[model samples]
Target: MTTLQGSAVFSACAQHRHRLDRWWSDEPRALVCAANPSRTDALRPDPTMCRLAALVRHRPGLGGFVLVNVEDRIATDPADLRRWLETADPAAVEVARRDNLARIRALAATAPLRIVAWGTLVPPGPHRDRVIAALSADGRHDLFAFGLTEAGVPVHPLARGPSRVPLGAPLVLWRAADEPS
Candidate 1:
């Protein structure tokens, strides 16, 4: 497959577009949506959701169902999630997952779907196999995760790294290599 590289803004827009096709009503695919806390500004999800929703609103798709969850925090309230789902095309939220099996079972009812388990960590543990098995049983769910590098840099497989750190102009513009003594 071909890969495209661009600025962060471009990448975000591309991600939004890809997710739109996956979760929009016209295509009617089931989704397990989550975001990395660092990568996504949860407070401003409209731009993100709207991009996904617009696909459904504009396209003649089949489903607009999504089981939304947040990374590392299972206590996120469904009611409080309304702001996250605020868009022209709203998605149906599923219960938070304390166990992976339960989520897979919940999603079985909605098959031929795309499952997106974004921004969660399932390290080598007792429950890891069970979660993998649960995901394997369903052909539709596309599970994803996000985490930080050893150096504390936030990373996503889909994104390039090491992530850029914000630097002020005076420092950023300094170029010792180009300086002539």
Candidate 2:
């Protein structure tokens, strides 16, 4: 799995706010909102929205739809996404992912559909962006990578055990268009 840093995500959102805004209004859009909830350092969805707002404000085409649990194939399915969001007493893994969905849904109701990505993080899961890409390949959504950072991008190694991926680095997340599978 690729280790995409939060900083990279943040930078992309900032640099491409205009493109993202435009894409939201005109083209389909999606984001791998979270690689790891603990890694993001965002407890509430407000910061997430703030980051998304930066792009949504500029790109009106960036509809408010995020891909949750981007690291897992089954978790990202449209049906699975709905189940995760609606489930009660979910497992710890589901809880983390659901939290992201909860925040995203809340953001959607409060703000227009601007930012789109998966909000959930499940342990021993695939990389966030990779899962998103898989879903994209499955015709679940679309993406655009017009504005990306040049340095300090984090990369997920997809290792096992309790080792944490290093942070405070730059990372790159590639976006995709939801073409027919």
Candidate 3:
């Protein structure tokens, strides 16, 4: 089996280091998802990633998963970071989103599942909407999402408890508003 370590998958993500942050494992049974990069320079997995790895281990047919974010740059203040990304150069954000989607597609092609865990922090916009849609569009891959927060947003891996709650069906988070409450 081709491992993510030292594989083209890693290379593909590394190439986008200038625009986005990325993380992965050599394991093939990975679940790719989104989050803002932590406020640090280390390339290693952070606490949130460690939590996600633990959560996935409890589920059947999942060994581990890799983590990626909508934005690659470290966000010292994630709340402000979201605002910055929302107002930043639209063209640049679109480019980064496209690159992120491409990387996710490549990883999901081999992974057992992909999770939409960017959470409410990522503002709803055309670019964010499209990325979420693309991640679930490929029927060949099985996509899942964590339980929603009190405000009905998908719970980020770090904010969620360690319990192995059932993963919900793949959802286009932006469209969730139309669904009856």
Candidate 4:
């Protein structure tokens, strides 16, 4: 994954949008679901995306890791993000959640690599769990994550250095039905 260039495909709402999608070429698109959107968009990318881009350069197949989020709202500040998630208008939140999931599904249709890396930002469940369930749905289940964060979710891209090995391995969450409860 060393400097594989491709077109940038960004699907986002207007200025005050709920979510955004920043994707690159189509060598092997991997679906990456994070806690929420930072200040990154098509025009400008934040440090998290920067770190992810560098990390992917070392690994081959993880090219064009498309980023989604457990929460759709964009918030650079953790406190503000949490508040929005908890206090935002229900109708708006629902709309954003649905839009995000639809984009994830559309991307997952072609992407072989799907990862769940929301960290502890998603209240340990709900939004995170919802996204996982959605990814596991439609009978096409395949998910992965780099490493475990302190919150026990997948390790965030920002937390890793290029020295790390392959992107991530398959997760049991992908095989939800096969596992016994």
Q: What is the C-alpha RMSD of each candidate to the true structure, in Å?
A: 16.6, 13.5, 6.3, 4.3
Ranked by TM-score from best down, the candidates are: 4, 3, 1, 2
lDDT of each: 0.33, 0.33, 0.54, 0.60
- Per-residue CA lDDT of model 3 for 38-128, tens digit only, reads 5322345556655655555545555455666666545646776667677889887677767777866665566656676766677777756
lDDT of 4 by residue, 1-181 (tens): 2333433333455323333444444457667777767656566767777766655544566446777777666677778876876798889878878877776677667766666666556664465556766665554565666666544556666655532324444243423333321
Top TM-score hit: 4
Shift in Å, residue 101, candidate 4: 1.4
Regions of candidate 3 where Cα sits further than 4 Å from its true position: 1-27, 39-45, 86-88, 138-142, 160-181
Clashing pairs in 4: 1-57, 147-155
* Candidate 3 least-lDDT 10 residues: 1-10
Name the weakest run of 10 consecutive residues (lDDT summed) in model 1. Answer: 167-176
Query: Clashes in model 3: which pairs?
Result: 20-72, 21-72
Residue 52 displacement in candidate 3 (angstroms): 1.2
Which regions of candidate 4 deviate over 4 angstroms? 1-26, 160-181
Off by over 4 Å in 2: 1-32, 38-45, 67-130, 139-142, 151-181
Give the best candidate by lDDT. Answer: 4
Off by over 4 Å in 1: 1-23, 33-62, 68-100, 116-120, 138-158, 162-181
